[model samples]
Target: MQQQVYHSLVYHSQSIQAWEKRWFQQQNSSYGLMQQMAWAISQQLGTLFFRQKIKKIAVCCGQGNNAGDGYLVAKYLKQAGFQVEIYAAEPGSSRDLATAVQEAKQAGLQPYSQFDFQTEYEAYVDALFGIGLNRQLDSNWQDIIYGINRQNGLKISIDIPSGLGANTGQPMPVAIKADYTFTGLGFKAGLFTGQGKEYAGKIELISVIPADTELQPIAQLASHQIQLPKRQTFGHKGSYGHVLVIGGHANMGGAVIMAAEAAFAAGAGKVTIACDAKHHTAILSRAPNIMLRDINALTVEQRIALIQQVDAVCFGMGLGRDEWAKEQYQAWFDLIQNSDLEIVLDADALWFLARQPQILNSKTYATPHSGEAATLLQKGTQEIELDRVAAIHTLQQKYQGQWLLKGSGSLILEEKLYICTAGNAGMGTGGMGDVLAGMIASLKAQFKQKIHLHEIVTLHALAGDELAKNGQRGLQAQDMKHAIYQVVNR
Candidate 1:
């Protein structure tokens, strides 16, 4: 099976349930689907045990089909000469679960309701709750989850960790933290974003349903293999579109410099920086290939003329929320309102826009982290991070343009939501967003005939991942310029 097929399409809990229903209809019984799921889990565990030499195992069983899968795993492990025990967290509630428990007992495996925290198991299986869980775990369950976390073993979750919202990826006050999560049927959207990403480590997709089963995913994970258009050998500097990067107020020249350098690295034909005059000498000394302009001295007419000359514009890296910043923002805003040039808004530009919200008509893209997104939506960062999909939709609907919510799982919302899964923790440093903003503008300028927002976002993140190959710590934004060239040229 192609892993890309599973990685690209992410379905929510509702969609997963609908797909399960389709499978149940095809199989003529829900138990048949359960049996297949059990067989898959047993097969996966068999392979894992053989490779890791895992002998002692414990399965935490709940009341639903998840527990049914656990019981079957224990049965197969026992039959294969492994020391396996079942710790029943809850009584089997549904008929399928009850039948599964009876079958496992008939297979000579006994389940204990009381948990022995001191038991030394090489691996622990979590089947307390899967996609159906919606609420916080109770005190008893929290204790068990905490105990599981304390255990020195391989912690594997069945579908999703217990106490995690299947649709939202927000965990309860406390949730199970699994080292590995084997999701069934389809990949859950919750597993790839938010707190779920931290908890659900090393995801493995278990294909229990037929490949032809129809599942409309809510979002597609950004592909790392997206290729840019080939450049002509006879093309000159003027062949590609020009990009104008406007930002870097006093003492913040590095921001716009990084942006310009990134744009140049991303294959922009001509890159210009309209920044404060204070950094002109430093910028020219470092990056002499970029064109420079004194943003403080440029009149509105000159700004509009600059905007007219460029195919794409990127704004708001280190642009302070001062009177000068407002003037620069307003000048560009007026020109953007009158022109159809591609635009990317980030950092302080987003702050100014949040102060006075308007529906933009031009081809605009907004890149806001959780805090910036919260300010735009007039909500708390916690609220925005809780359900990033909802927050992105809300921001796009209000702003009326493409929005990219930058975080661990950067989400780009244009016609559809796309989750970029390429970046690493090394990208959390400063000036990274500036590089990303410049890259988006450069790609938009070079590919004006189509919408490649998601592609640029993915490329920027993949570049960061490439740079982080050395080490995540002390990874600089400047280190990614070569990586960006490598990704775009590839």
Candidate 2:
């Protein structure tokens, strides 16, 4: 059995099933694995109930193997002297499940008087469905999940929550919101990414069998610890790297200022700002180190000259969606598109890319939150949120570049995939995206191949977490400057 740990591999539901099938094929009793899982779960449940002084628990069982686990858990808990009652959605359909039901009955865990579960208990065990469920739940299942969610008891889900796709992390119309989800077999991708963090709650990975050597994990949970290279004693400003941050419309100078500052905070040797001259004074006032170029005055030849001077460019912060913004976008975008400079496309850059779809180079990084992702993919925000892992992959496939889909579980897809689990709700304020754009531009320019895209993203999230330590409520993106400096130096 695998022990629960943070920052492990995440797999699809099919991989989990494949491992199970292989285990059963070796003449190992499938029923035995079911009992093993239930017993382990029952042990954990007993400890929790004992500590909480919870004596009464309602185990709601469906017709599948998941219900079999529920039935066995009720029996084990009842034997431990808890007031346990079993309620089934239907009779056990599988032979092993039926056997589990009978064994539980033999252990004296009889069915509750009310099958509809009218009576409340100290806690509730959700076993209505598992990873096998992908399609939208019908009215009956939805009603069941809804009723369970309405209950005030401590809710614990067996395996994945009912009505949630094990692959997509999407609730199928409705799903149980568990206080602790004791996921058996392995860590499912849906249980870690997308909306899985909300529904799954605290996760405990239980291994029923050893993973097959052939199975490959879809993504890795981003590590909290990040180590950066130490600065050399002989290094000067030009020895580090130069980052050019483009965008700051006549009305929106603040975006360019934030991005440029973030670049400096992330340890860029030299940072330049290319925006309207109206914003140059403000940019220099806030960050005296940042060189400025008036976006309106720069000719195409000068644009190419500027691109050549910088190792990386962070584009499209605060560039408004207007005629002037569009014209600036076209001139800069075309030059940047044809050039080999490491690029970070964000905000209005993403907007322009959506308007004029282009196959980005491998060196480019595109960061889009759910809303921006919708614009880029021509899908609704809710649709992108439904399955963020899939959305990031889609973005990468459509536009050939490193993609970061920012949300609760920030998905990163470069050559492989990664899910960032470090950020908090406090990092949700305005201008946070600008901060991230700057960080990416600065780091890519400095490190180049010395670092990975996922590492840069994790570092950004870590910076956000550090700022959130004071409090997430009023945390501003501007506050990230100090946090980034603190984290990078460490």
Model 1 vs. true fold: TM: 0.95
Top of the candidates by lDDT: 2
For candidate 2, the TM-score is 0.93
**Total clashing pairs in model 2:** 0
State each model's CA lDDT, in order. Answer: 0.84, 0.87
State model 1's lDDT: 0.84
lDDT of 1 by residue, 100-189 (tens): 899889988788875774478999988888899877777887887888888998888888887778767788767778888888887777
TM-scores for all predictions: 0.95, 0.93
Give a tens-digit lDDT track for model 2, residues 1-490: 1122353888888888888888888999999999999999999999999999999899988888988898898988898899998988666569988998898889887775324775778899988887888678888778888888999999999998887778878889888999999999777888877778779888888776777787788998777667788889999999888999999989999988888889999999999999989988777778787898888888888988999998999999998899998988888887897888899999998998999999998889999999999999999999888778788889988998899998777888977888887788788789999999999999988889777787888888899988888788999998899999998898
Query: Candidate 2, clashing residue pairs?
Result: none
User: Number of backbone collisions per candidate, in order?
Assistant: 0, 0
